[model samples]
Target chain A: MQLSPSLSALVEALRCLPGIGPKSAQRIAFHLLERDRSGGTQLGQSLLNAMDKIGHCESCRTFSETPVCDICSNIKRQDTGLLCVVESPSDVLAIEQTGQYQGLYFVLMGHLSPLDGIGPNEIGMDVLERTLANGNINEVILATNPTVEGEATAHFIGEMCHQHNVTASRIAHGMPVGGELELVDGMTLMHAFSGRKAI
Target chain B: MQLSPSLSALVEALRCLPGIGPKSAQRIAFHLLERDRSGGTQLGQSLLNAMDKIGHCESCRTFSETPVCDICSNIKRQDTGLLCVVESPSDVLAIEQTGQYQGLYFVLMGHLSPLDGIGPNEIGMDVLERTLANGNINEVILATNPTVEGEATAHFIGEMCHQHNVTASRIAHGMPVGGELELVDGMTLMHAFSGRKAI
Candidate 1:
């Protein structure tokens, strides 16, 4: 089914969003045009404003409107020597929401995907190396996802930290809190058992 | 945790979309800022362009860039005297996609919601009455949804058609095609049985 030219353009453009398929794009386009024109205008202006003003932070490579991100520039975070390595800005936001980590972060923006030709350089590993070489960071925390690509990237970064004489550590792999043992995956249960700490 | 000013603005604006909550809005914002900057810009431009160009058709109240909608202006439709009354522009699009309804439509833009102060005048029912009084229409088809407000609006429109000396009919409500009998709701099954016709 063909929509009007402007409606079709809106639908196509909306499909750029992550997880939004053609049907969702069409629904959103029709919704905006039918009932919420003012809201649609606001969303458009907001997108343009964000795209025009936001850029990567020089120190951590996370999104920021200024040269350095808020977390990177803040001196009050108590653990400046501890750096958590993550895959994307969303990961940083997720960690921040936990309110448990007081350390800085290095955002890789993506994982190593050999088939896609995205390697160390493509995800700014060189910049991470330069930051590690500065000798201020005493401990590096590998907090990438548990996926295959995330694990490989974390292992590579751990090796880099070893070479730089910085203490390297990975966030513990185990069953989640309040999760039943039967529901936990086999690999996670095995990892939890092997990494059990002394009481 | 607070995002950058523009990023927060983008997230807030994105929440205006239907079915999108705070978490989804944030995820979409981060996705656009991280990987699809160009696409984000295109989406922004498209929204602005669509909003600037699209307007309600003067005759049937459906979306159109011109004064009269394409359906209303089309000279080749089989029955110009058959008018379909629908709730919104999306409803018109849905009917058009079926390839069965060749008649023009009157879009109400909303149903009768007395609690929300949306009555006949609010949904352009007076204009519909004026159109029916023109004596060009022979039959009016009530195609509103099965919801309470939609039923009320259809009944009100039916009364108006009766006063104008025009024949009124309603779309059938029953079990969907290919639907399993056990899975169908009791009310729908009852409707199907009562409305059954001779082959």
Candidate 2:
């Protein structure tokens, strides 16, 4: 069906969102037009504000509105000198939700993918090297994803840690909490066995 | 986790979309921020334009940028004098896809539901009354949904057609084209039996 020009444009633009296709876009447009014009207007304003105002934190490369993010700016976290390195801002949020760790973070924004030409410099290793050389952080926790790219990125950062005489550790790769042993993958089971400690 | 003020506001506004909860809203916000900032900006403009410009078609009560929708403005459809009455604008699109009907449409935007305080007038029956009273429309096809409310609405409009001496018919209900008889519900099986036509 031929939609009104504005409606068609709205539907097409909505497709930029992850997983929304043409039929879903049409439904969303109609729903907004019919029942939630005020909500649509509010969403539009929010989108514009966020896209225009939000930028990466200078210290961590995570999304931020200011020069440094809240975690990086906290003096108490700075004193701990425990830096958790993650691949994205969402991972920072995930780790923060645990509330068990009290440390600052350095978000790479992405992991190394050599074929994609994402070298150490591409993932902000230069900034990381600068941070390490300053000697503030005692330990760097590599909490990037467990994929091959994440591992390669972590190994590269580990070498940087050794050069600066700072300790480097990787986040564990055992079965998830509340996951059954039977359901665990072979790679994870092997990691769990190999990394076992006296408990 | 405490998000930046703008990010928090964007997540909240994204909840206005249908079926999107907090997690989905956050995912969409982060996805836009990380991967498709341009799409987000374009979507923002589209939302603002659609909300500000799109209005209900005066002739059919369907969404339209102009006073009348494209279908209603077509001279040939006006000359046909066959008006299909439906519950919403999407229904107009559904029927139009068949390419069998060369007629006009009157969208009620909703069906009769007295429990929700919806009455004939609430569903634009007054406008429908005038349309039928005017001799322009020859046939009124009731194509409201097959719910209890839809049946009541169609019955109500059918009475109005009688008052105006206009022939009124209902869209048939039976087994859907691809539906199996074994899987069809009792109500629909009854409809199929009752609505069976002799070839």
Candidate 3:
């Protein structure tokens, strides 16, 4: 027999989540219908509110309900004149968690992916170039991931910074502090050796 | 730094889904915001619709958008005078997928668990008892999971069936089909021996 109409719709809709398969969708649907209707309703309302209100920061291209994000608007952070470039808002969150950096950010949202037809314009490179040309920033820290696409994206942005006469620096690559050398991948070891400095 | 209000609320609300933690919730929130706002909004509408409409089947206690679920409202299935009892509506879906069971069902929605304060009433045993008292069902099949609590619940319901002079049968416990005998658990092997049937 067919599942109840709304139940089936909820199960089908839940597959919009990244990792959920049919079974997981059904399980989640049953869970909400059976145990937590209120939570489900709350999530529904939250999703609607977020999708409707959350837009990109006009300055950094990161998620923000306001036109300019908190970090972008902070005079203290803006005065630092150091803009860290990265892909995705989650990276911004990670860097903020460290509480080490005291500057603003420029979120690429994605990197160059030529084969899939993604290019500089697709990832808001034009905006980054405009920010660089404004010349308020002292340095551009490219903290994009070390993957091939991330590297290519960083290289492209570095050229833009050079054109605008802004200093550009790629974040250092080395062995992670807490990782064991034996378990580390060969590529990481190679980078560690190449990037070594005197203590 | 604080996530934007709606973004943070979406992240918090996403944790209501089973198996989602803070990190996964954030990832999902970002993914939807960046890549699939339409899908996210669709899920929101679906969740609202399902949560608002879906309720338990009046007859079997399975999820239903209407007063009675499709299976329970079927005259052909109900006239068969058989009622299969299961712990959750998902089990009914599983059984329906097999295309084997031909009768109506009675869903407990949960099993007896004294330690957690769950009892017959919590599992809707009173509903089952009423169905039996109505004197329409000839047999009651106990198809709860094979865990210890499930076994105890089945036993309790079996006693209830006996009191009402209704035949009750637990789903067989033995090695699964296509399972390797050597790899089967010891308890399953023992049950296989005890439940062996002659061709």
- Please give the ranking of all candidate structures by TM-score, highest first, separated by commas: 2, 3, 1
Name the best candidate (by lDDT): 2
lDDT of 1 by residue, A19-97 (tens): 8898899889879988899999999999999999999999999999999888888786525699999999989988998
What tens digits encode model 3's per-residue C-alpha lDDT throughout A66-85? 99999999999989999999
Which residue pairs collide, candidate 2? Answer: none
Error of 2 at A166 (Å): 1.4
Q: Is candidate 1 or candidate 2 better by DockQ?
A: 2
**Candidate 2 residues A1-199, lDDT tens each?**
6878999999999999899999999999989998999999999999999999999988888999998889889999999999999999899899989899999899998999989888888889999999999899999999989988899889999998999999999999898999999999999999999989997
Where does model 3 exceed 4 Å of error?
none
Please give the lDDT score at residue B38 for candidate 1. Answer: 99
Cα lDDT, model 3, residue A60? 91
TM-score of 1: 0.93
RMSD, model 3, all Cα superposed? 1.6
Model 3 chain B: which ten-residue window has the lowest total lDDT?
B56-65
Interface RMSD over true interface Cα atoms for each candidate? 1.4, 0.8, 0.7
Backbone clashes in each candidate structure, one number apiece? 0, 0, 0
* Model 3: pairs clashing at backbone N, Cα or C within 3 Å: none
- lDDT: worst 10-residue window of model 3 chain A: A1-10
Judge candidate 1 against the unseen true structure and give its global Cα lDDT, from 0 to 1: 0.90
